[model samples]
Target: MSRIEWERIGRERRRVSRWSGGTTAEIAIHPATSQYAARNFAWRVSTATVEAERTDFTPLDGFSRILMVLENELTLHHEGHGTYRLRPYEQNAFEGGWRTSSEGRATDFNLIYDSRLRARMSVLEVPGEAALVAAVGSLPCEEGEHWIHRIWYTAEGSVEAADAGGNALCRLDAGDALLFAVHRSHGEESWSLRNAASGRAVVIESVVFS
Candidate 1:
């Protein structure tokens, strides 16, 4: 985990892996390690689908998942529970177990974190600026002992964020995500903006206390 690293998501990147019960999707593993499979909890980004008349999935022991619809609309049904609908860009949460059922189809982003770890998470919709005059000495360093992780997703227009060293860390379009981690003490850090889109940009930040 270093101060700043650029990330990009593209086709043929092999970011996806298939799951049990006949589900297909892509996955991006942060910290990209083989030990993660047996760890208490790990953050995984995935895109999954739900076909018509499909029902039941084993409850992930000590794990919870957050769903963000990326494509299509879907209606979810649970045994002894009610039905809920999610559209593109909308979000919802569901327990993974045999009780969950699905009808129709959808493609969604999943945030799977082990419940035993008690890690907290949240998603924020960042507002876009019309324009920004980026300078050479923008991103400064910070000094502290706390851990800070920042990620920006392209929801509207293009964005470029870098450190004071003039390294191009992120250049993203709509539906792209960038991850940043600061491992040591740092100073002031700044973000630069170029051509902006009308709609607001969205960012998802997760803090884990171990």
Candidate 2:
């Protein structure tokens, strides 16, 4: 059987935490654990706002992390890799075990997954209607034996995901998301997203466990 799921997380449903550096607001997580323990989660997505003061990130011994700046700019200093200055929508990937620290204030999105799972994240910016359609049409649809999941998150503006036949799957506004899953299945399936309003829209695409 083929299946797809859509989940809209309002700002209120998100969990906010105050850290020494600043604050972290969770967007969504896999396995749906009740607590925020790293070992209980296979994957996690959240937004962290760093304060001006330098702060060290918690070490996740066996995980990989993708970080993207959504508001303002920040620099991440990795113990061995040097410093990474990220502007709005810029993304960087690093091993969670790396001793990392951040300076400057900025709101950033994060995607963390256990090292056992393969995952990749990219930021997409659609400037106009035509560009939005093209971006949606370019989503990858691969056939494979292993299960593959794709998560589309609207960082700014609004968009809608649909099938090849123009059937609406879901609408995503700023901070909203759509998650699509595919396992061993027959036949081909294609999914795409289009801008819902006139203006630029930013989306974060995450391909997991592929």
lDDT of 1: 0.53
Candidate models: Cα lDDT each: 0.53, 0.76
Candidate 1's TM-score reads 0.64
Q: How do the residues 96-187 of candidate 2 rate in per-residue lDDT, one tens digit apiece?
A: 99999988788898988888777888877756555344222233445542655667788999887776566776778887877666553434
Q: What is the lDDT of residue 178 in candidate 2?
A: 71
lDDT of 1 by residue, 159-198 (tens): 6554555555556565566655544345554545444456
Error of 1 at 207 (Å): 5.7
How accurate locally is residue 78 in candidate 1, as Cα lDDT from 0 to 100? Answer: 65
- Candidate 2 runs further than 4 Å off: 131-145, 184-187
Give the CA lDDT, 0 to 100, for residue 158 in model 2. Answer: 87
Which pairs, if any, clash in model 2?
none
Best by TM-score: 2
